[model samples]
Target chain A: MNEIRIFSPATVANVSCGFDVMGFCLDSVGDEMVIRKVERKGIHITRIEGFDLPYEAEKNVSGVSALAMYDAIDVDFGFEIEIYKKIKPGSGIGSSAASAVGSVFGMNELLGRPFNKTQLTEFAIKGEALASKCEHADNLAPAMFGGFALVKSVSPLVILEIPSPEDLYATIIHPQIEIKTAESRALLPKEVALQDATTQWANFGSLIHGLHTGDFEVIKNALHDVIVEPHRSKLIPYFNEVTKAAINAGALGSGISGSGPSIFSLSKGIENAINVKDAIEKVYAKTGIDFDIHVSKINSKGIKIIN
Target chain B: MNEIRIFSPATVANVSCGFDVMGFCLDSVGDEMVIRKVERKGIHITRIEGFDLPYEAEKNVSGVSALAMYDAIDVDFGFEIEIYKKIKPGSGIGSSAASAVGSVFGMNELLGRPFNKTQLTEFAIKGEALASKCEHADNLAPAMFGGFALVKSVSPLVILEIPSPEDLYATIIHPQIEIKTAESRALLPKEVALQDATTQWANFGSLIHGLHTGDFEVIKNALHDVIVEPHRSKLIPYFNEVTKAAINAGALGSGISGSGPSIFSLSKGIENAINVKDAIEKVYAKTGIDFDIHVSKINSKGIKIIN
Candidate 1:
């Protein structure tokens, strides 16, 4: 086919106990993109709606990722792109990742799927680096391959797709505030105590086991962050209150979604996720901050073709 | 019912990428112990053989663990322990754990199993602390529950039992040298770079996934230790050469078994394990170090009842 339309998902990165390594996709929140093959020999952005982002092909994340994929292939025809951005930028929910994954995923489909998930992630992360100022695949992997993605390494780029429980759901709260990725990252210390690192890895290993075994109790116990959250959470208002509210409302666990300004909690079912969302909403309402909340099932499919 | 004989398996702990948290049991290397009940009201050590150890109930590891178990229960009779120890102390292959696990496992069986595995691990770690000078369950959990064990946490201890591949085998080479656990631990840096910690946890999470899916390639790639190996390997002479030899001989991965002196390598089958053992032995032979090599299958059953 010469044309393709796809739904590229929003994702939660820096999952508790799995900072810089783990992330999962969301089904209910995403961005829509359409790509069409043209006879010309260059990539072009035909339209963008709902968010003011750089429209220049070289400046946009979608364009950068598409260029990364496009350069690796021998395609005679060029591509035209249109994006309907719904996941806001700097909301800590992988807005840039959606754009980055969308372009590569759609281009691959249009080219009859020449690249695998790992290659797609490599190309997507190049675009992700433009936004985060650092290259990490935690968000890109899940948005590209779906379910739970564990980025085992970044240099060699190994992404392990872990199975999520069928009933698992996510509740996300995105406060409409911008926390620059570089500034948020600067809040972290360059070094961490060895003892704390051990605890983090222990919980990380246990969380992976819990997901495999479908044991909610293990998941609940394992969802703790001793490394990153203690520092970054201070940047987001009501962060502690929202997390406590989510847990009290029956979330398995809750933590800062990515850098800041967005928080996520995971639960067993849609009903419980809704309860967590409601509880978080009540906590955030008093802060006088404009925010958006979403309840999503774990998106096992990642980026998907759409009509 | 008054008397019980058991074989308590030795364990390899601090498996690469899972320091202080992961371990596995060995079928061919362990200690044999016999425990019997008497009309008295306290725990006692009746005989010692094969290895020299304290005979008192409180000072000996076997006795210490048994007393811990005995005091928590309303047992009507005192216990007598006869040890036919085969594992050497300071060998870094869970010699103390075998002794510690033996008394509790035999006593639990004799008392009709009043405590669960976690409780038993708790009691066993107390005995392990006598040897290691710290409380960590990497070895104890594997010796008690068998196969692979991940000590997910210490306080509110959580041990996750991971399934081993059917054909997995271990090759252990113990160079007859001494490295005290306390001294070995002191060589480590109290703080580690965040980048190194991230790399460690990534490999750790991937290793757990590899074990679950029985993927040898994933296991080979994931079996790495960036944090502890660089420092600890210095204590073990010809460490890098032995590890290289094992890998060259087709072992999946190799690292320091515990604190030091003993090096362990994992292979896919008994034949590969033997090949790895030969390779390791060849390297250590030139060093003029008196060493013992053991090839054993993965012990799925931790402590077995013996005649």
Candidate 2:
């Protein structure tokens, strides 16, 4: 078998009410993992890029995903995986998902595509679950299909590819800090008030409609997160300032992007998106937090060989 | 004005998450109202058709709405009103709203368009408070606009027109019975469980997206009305059968039309719509009470005047 160089774009999961159900892949921002087949049956992953957080096959996302796929199928050969981690962990940008998706997708080519995208999605889910402690599909769908896709129901793994609006621009500002999924989940209330719960769903419904129709105004109106954002906002140093600045700079809506420390804002066009990034970065800069801004459209192309 | 003839269509209010803020007009059955300026300075009631209703200027809907508009805007001439009721009252259909909108619309024409449709919407809102004791805009937007519209904010009255998907069919079946609005509304709890409310909103958000994108599958999946339907289902006889039957008959989704005694269902095409109607009506027929079935497309056109 031949060696393949593959890149899986980072994703934003739980795009407001989408919770484990919605996500979109970023075009240029993500992790790149490369895999090569060997003669014997086993999995080997060398750290080419990305932080070497854990190395055990069960503990490492990239290795575990490839190992699971190969073990389940009739693969007599082994594979070595390498990753280029451009998106930092805990960026609320689905860095973990990119690694797992990259592993499965890169290995599929070496195996002659024995499994469909859903089967590959399962492999990714199992791998990512080791870190997040929850089996959710929000992160996997975006990495699989790219662009703005909805994991309508994850039981059978259904993907709804919503037509990305012409002017849809994602202005993601990753504040240089870490807010792990565990701590972010810990800050939330076990039970929320009924009214707040209703508000969340209303926002969720509005966001879904907004994403589907590309109705920027509706998305703006519905960009509220009563449950998670309010509770988790304090975890970020300048959460309110960044969100307000982005909105003031013509962003359609801004929120804590999935267990955020790295806040993301969705804007209408490139100009507004840039303005949002500049404004948000200014506030974070004052806080002495280094940040990176990515201005891109919905990555309609999910996993690919970038190098 | 020489003469005024106006027809307002039936409307589905509280469309999913829009419980009170959203509604859309139906293309099929509604109410027809006609008014002519008389020489006298005071309004007079001439005739009523299609259903048994009151004729007094103070007690009747047409008389009350026409009187309100006349008082709000200066009218030098008196007028005679005629109403042909098509949508039965207390069917959870916009029965009272149709009359109110028609009166407001008909009078504006009789007075030579002193008030625009937007201005007349306020008068219609007044009628809503008069009937339901709650000021809701779900019915008013559709009644005035002719198609799918949203009541953005009621105090200032912002009615945003949302695009209606072309491939949609609404099947309305009015069971032969009555559930008074007060009684049905009474069944609802002011405070709901947090989890249930969240589910409702999520469903609602998806429903809105479905409406904008013309995705019937999303609409079907997101149609569970946990807040209103579950509690209110006990009021109508064989409610579960009707809903289950409509869904089983290929309906995109089904919910109580207004409050109940009427069930509203959606399908992708005309054939499925007819099937849903037949399936639901077959159950009501066995109870020895005939029901009215309305098969229609989403009314992109709200109110119309044909002489």
Candidate 3:
């Protein structure tokens, strides 16, 4: 009862049409953290694995989130968190989010669930802010709540979990290339055309409708990114050809995952999802670049207690 | 059936966060049109009532829509459309859309339903283009398909009908003032700040999620308009007071419908709808301005045959 371990799933943010607001979790790749009561009064990082992340409690995502949990609780409890990261850093698939969400989720469980999901999400976002320098819940919301989530606002912390069809499949490809989130975000335009904004909202609306109705064609049409993708896709290699190949191979929709270097496509069925993965790989095979492909369905279950 | 009669309902477009894409219909206030077969090989507007619209076939919305049906069918079918307008023109309640949707819907019914709802919507947008000088389906789509609708695109004509909770109520207030759609649209900035655009999409996404999930609090939070309402609401009399009054009186959400001169609020139940109407009326009573109020539920049945 004094020690617990949890796993937080990797997440894809933005989701093409909903920039800075929408995201969903992946079932497979993630980060694992083990929390145990320690003699010290403050949070401590005992060990880090899979990546050369900062071991300082104040500098790490999990440590910052643990600090937030301490600020929320009145008891003078202390813990040492050991993180095993499976998601690579700068992968644009919510690597930092997994650590942040895992810490808060694990700590809450270790303390016998003192806070609800919403409070845990708030703490996770505080941890995310330490990494991104801005507070956002697009990744943490889904990583905590699962399925598809829309973060309406960060102030009052309104996060809505949207229902997704059972057949929804996500095919993700992460190229072994690093694109810093700050550099990618800094490339965005300060202002966008009114017409493009209108189009983006329409797409976002249709995507929501399609998710509710389980209509694949509507999702296909709604998965276009008119604003962010046009600018951010430049950071990735063969972004256009890979997306086109996925679409040609029966993907319901395709787009860049999170920030860059990783691309994802959605399909209606497993066969189409595999076909899309192969089609994308066929294009990526030509570049001789190191890459990874993951075909997953919508992750309805987010973070889980492993031990 | 050589003769057909149909009524096209009034609609509230924009729907707060979704400008130019979202809309829903009203039940009681609308326009009626009667279509009958004729020996002449061309469409004609035989008689128009309640508005000083053009009698020429190419100039009238009904005539133009009937012409579009003729073009789509590729047959020399002659028809005469008589429009009885009950919805006031320039009231910002989709008056022109009523005529346009009524024409295409009645023509389709008289022609034995050759075109489906999507096709009929296409023809209706052509009719709307004659008046607004732009092809928009926000009003026409809901008037043709009923309930709430999201017009994804006008190019390939993607319109999706969204389901609504059965108890959802629409309370509308139309002030007898004229703010031309052209002038109102011209007031909008050609480019909007990226921050504002992101906020708008988040609201829009939440609104769609709320509508599908039937969560009133989500809808209440999502109904805020940051881009268009701030500028267009200035054109209407007592816009702020009316909206505040409606919300204060238990309405779920309130905002200016479409361009201006009319405001609408959504309530969860019939009693709340009535209370919202009364609260809005009490505010408008001080303005000494002529205005009409209509309380209705979501028009699940859109254009209907009268005979």
- Best DockQ among the predictions, by candidate number: 3
| lDDT per residue as tens, model 2, A1-307 | 5788887888887666555566777876877777888786687866655565675667787777777787787757778777778878778888778888888898887777888887898888888887688777778878888886666565666666656677778888887887767788778676666545655655665566566667787778877677677788899888888888988999887777767876778888889888888898788778877888888777888878756
Expressed as tens digits, the lDDT of each residue in B72-148 for candidate 1 is 98867898899999999999999999999999988888888888989998999889988877898999999999999
TM-score of each: 0.99, 0.88, 0.98
Q: What is the interface RMSD of each candidate, in Å?
A: 0.5, 3.5, 0.6
Fnat per predicted structure, each in turn: 0.84, 0.32, 0.96
Chain A TM-score per candidate? 0.98, 0.93, 0.98
Model 3, B257-287: lDDT tens digits are 8886889999999999999999988998988
Q: Please, what are the lDDT tens digits per residue for candidate 3 over residues A1-307?
A: 8788888899999999988899998887888889887767888999999999998989999999989998878766688999998899888889888999888888888788989998899998888999888999988999999999999999989889888999888999999988877789898999999899999999998888889889888888999999999999999999999999999999988898888678989998899999999999999999999999999878899999885
Instruction: List the lowest-lDDT window of 10 residues for candidate 1 chain B.
Output: B67-76
Model 3 achieves a DockQ score of: 0.92
What tier of docking accuracy does candidate 3 attain? Answer: high
Off by over 4 Å in 2: A17-20, A112-116, A186-215, B15-18, B38-80, B108-120, B150-167, B189-202, B209-215
What interface RMSD, in Å and to 1 decimal, does model 3 have? Answer: 0.6
After aligning candidate 2 to the native by TM-score, how far in Å is the CA of A170 from where it should be?
A: 2.4
Residue-wise C-alpha lDDT for candidate 1, range A107-221, written one tens digit per residue: 8888888999899989988888888788888999999999999999898999998987999999999999888767887999899999999999999999999999899988999
Name the runs in model 1 displaced over 4 angstroms: none
